[model samples]
Target: MSAEAVSALGLLGRVELPGVAGSICTARRYVRGVLRRSGQRDTYDAELLVSELVSNAVRHSESGRAGGLVTVAVANCGESVQIAVTDSGSATCAPRIPPGQDEGAEGGRGLWLVRELSLSWGWHEGAAGRIVWFRLARR
Candidate 1:
C-alpha cells in the first residue's frame, strides 16, 4: 500500500494531540491499542516508527509551537499496516536525511530507520500540512 492506503485502507485508528514531547509515548500507546484491537500482537516496530515520526513532527515542525497540533492515523490494509503522522507546516523543514550526517552520531537516524524498516514510505504536502507515512508488512 502507498498513498492509496490512506483512503483505500480506511483509517482505523486516528488521534490528534498537542505537539509536545510526551505525546510520543501517548501516540505509541494509542497505536498499540489500535493494533491490539485488530488482533495483532507484534507491535514493537510499529510503536517505534510512530515514536520517531511523532518526535520529528514535534521537534522539527512548526507544530512544536504553542497551540500547535499533530495528527496520527493508522490504517489496516489486508496484509500490511499503514501509519501516518501529520504536522503543521514548517517553514524551514520537511522530511529528509540530514546532509553529510555522521553515521556514528547519537541521533538523527529516525527517517533512516523508517526507510530501512518499512516496506514502502512517502509523504504528501497540502495547504494544511504535510503527512508522512510508512507501510509495514503484517507479521
Candidate 2:
C-alpha cells in the first residue's frame, strides 16, 4: 500500500525504544504484538528482520549515544507487512548492506539476513530522521 494510505488507514503502530543493546528484544516484542493483531503468519521472519534493523540502528547511529531513542513502526496493509526503523542519524554513515563480509568477524551479517528474508527493503533520509524499512509478503 502507499505510505499515505498506510497512515490514513491507521494500519501503522509504532514504539519508541531506548537506543541500547537490550532494547532489541523490546522492539521484537512490540512488533510481535502488532503482527499478531494483524493476523500475520510470518511473524518469525518479520521479528528477525526487525531485530536486525534495530540492532543496526542502535549499534551504528547517533541513537546509541546518550539519551537517544529509536523508533520502530509496523504497518499491516492486508497483503503485506511493512516495518520501518528510524534512528538518530549518523554524520559519518548511512544505513547500507556492507560491501562484503568477513565470515571470521563476530558480527556485520544482520543486513544480509534482512535481504534474504525481506521481499523488498530500502532506506531514506527523511525530515524525522534516517529510516530503514522492509516489506514481506503475507503467507
Off by over 4 Å in 1: 1-5, 99-101
For residues 1-139, could you state the per-residue lDDT of candidate 1 as single tens digits? 2345567887787889999998999999999999888888898999999999999999999999999998999998889998999898787887997777688899999998898899988877865588988989877
**Candidate 1: TM-score?**
0.91
Worst 10 residues of 1 by lDDT: 1-10
**What is the model-wide C-alpha lDDT for candidate 2?**
0.84
Candidate of highest TM-score: 1
Lowest-sum lDDT 10-residue window in model 2: 1-10
| The best candidate in terms of lDDT | 1
For candidate 2, lDDT tens digit of each residue in 26-139? 999999888887777658998898999899898899999999899998886567888889898899988767877888888888888888888888888776688898888876
